[model samples]
Target: MNEQLEFVVRAAAIGTGATAVMDLWGLFLKRTLAIPPLDYAWVGRWIGHFPRGRFAHANIAQAPRIRGETPVGWVAHYTIGIVFAALLMAVWGLDWARDPTLLPALVVGMSTVVAPFFIMQPAFGAGIAASKTHNPSTARLRGLITHLSFGVGLYAAALFSAHLFPI
Candidate 1:
């Protein structure tokens, strides 16, 4: 494969793996502590309203439901993951993927919280960093932990890719 194509493939794989890891972490939390995972359907609803010129909501839960929201949300979730992975590679270079390291992955992963804190959360009507939620601190903590897990996933996925591809 050509260099750019190989990079794209690798980024997609790494991002998917990282997103899966994040989901697994959510599942673990839910199973062990009864903590519910994020309902991506809300994300879909938010995105679904895009064409209607609706961006921000006071309470996304109160927003009207969109058709195929669940699928759209899930796809957006994974696509975001892939974009983040591609960003990591872009900043650190493909060499980082070949010789994977924890710090860079973690940095990129954790930093992704910026999106939800500023963009997604606000647009979802949760306020910045989920401040409008019932419990902002807990919400923030959960988000941090989730993002941290994604960071770990990035490292793990990169390591796995290196082992599997060896190129």
Candidate 2:
């Protein structure tokens, strides 16, 4: 494969793997601790409002439901994961994907917390880093844990990707 194609394949594989790992972690939390996973439908609803010139919501739950929001949110979620994987490649280069290191993956994974904390949370009316949530500290911690899992996932996935899509 051409270098560009190889890059794209690796990015998509790594990102998808990382995101799946994150989701599995979320599932573990829910099953073991009774912690609930994030409702991606909200993400879909939030994005659905964009076409209507709506950006931020006082409470996304109260926002009008969008058709197919569940699927939309899921697609967006995975796509975001893919984008982040691409970011990992962009920052560390394709060589990282080939070598599959931990630090860089962890760094990028953990850093992804900024998206929900600053952008997604605020837009969802959850406030910065979930500051406005019912329990801000708990929310923050959960987010941190989730992102850390993603980081770990990035590393694991990169390793798998290296094997699956060898350079």
Candidate 3:
């Protein structure tokens, strides 16, 4: 394979693996803290409306339901994870994946919070950084923690990859 292509392949693997780690963390939080996991169905509903000319919602729960929204949401969730992983590779380079450092992975992971804070939140009607939610500050804090976890996930995935591939 070409050098760039090899990088992309490795990046995809790392990103997807990292996302899986993040998801496991989410499950742990839900079980330990009694916090309900995110309902990707809402994310699907939000995305489903795009073609119909809707972009933002006052409350996603109030939005019309979409068929197969759960599956769609899950797909989006994992896909987003892969994208984040790819982004980590892009910024830190494939060498990071080979060596598996901490700061770079964590930094990239935390920075991903912007997507939910500004894009996903506002689009879902929660406002920027979840400002429109009933408890905006709490919501924001949770989001930060979640993103930080993702950063940790990135590190874990990279470490695992290094162990497995050992290139």
State TM-scores per candidate: 0.98, 0.98, 0.93
lDDT tens digits by residue: candidate 2, 1-167: 99899889988999999999999999999999999999999999999999999999999999999999999999999999999999999999999999988999989999999999999999999999898999999999999999999999999999998888765
- Local accuracy of candidate 1 as per-residue lDDT tens digits, 38-127: 999999999999999999998898999999999999999999999999999999999998899999999998999999999999998899
Model 2, position 75, has a per-residue lDDT of: 96
Among all windows of ten consecutive residues in candidate 3, which has the lowest summed lDDT? 1-10
- The segments of candidate 3 whose C-alpha lies over 4 angstroms from its true place after superposition are none
Candidate 1 lDDT at 129 equals 98
Candidate 1: residue 151 Cα off by (Å): 0.4
lDDT of each: 0.95, 0.94, 0.83
How far in Å is the alpha carbon of 26 misplaced in model 3?
Answer: 1.9
- In angstroms, give how far residue 163 of model 2 lies from its true place: 0.9
lDDT of 1 at 100: 99
Q: After superposition, how far is residue 114 of candidate 1 from its true place, in Å?
A: 0.4
Query: On a 0 to 100 scale, what is the lDDT of residue 154 in model 1?
Result: 96
Task: List pairs with backbone clashes in candidate 3.
Answer: none
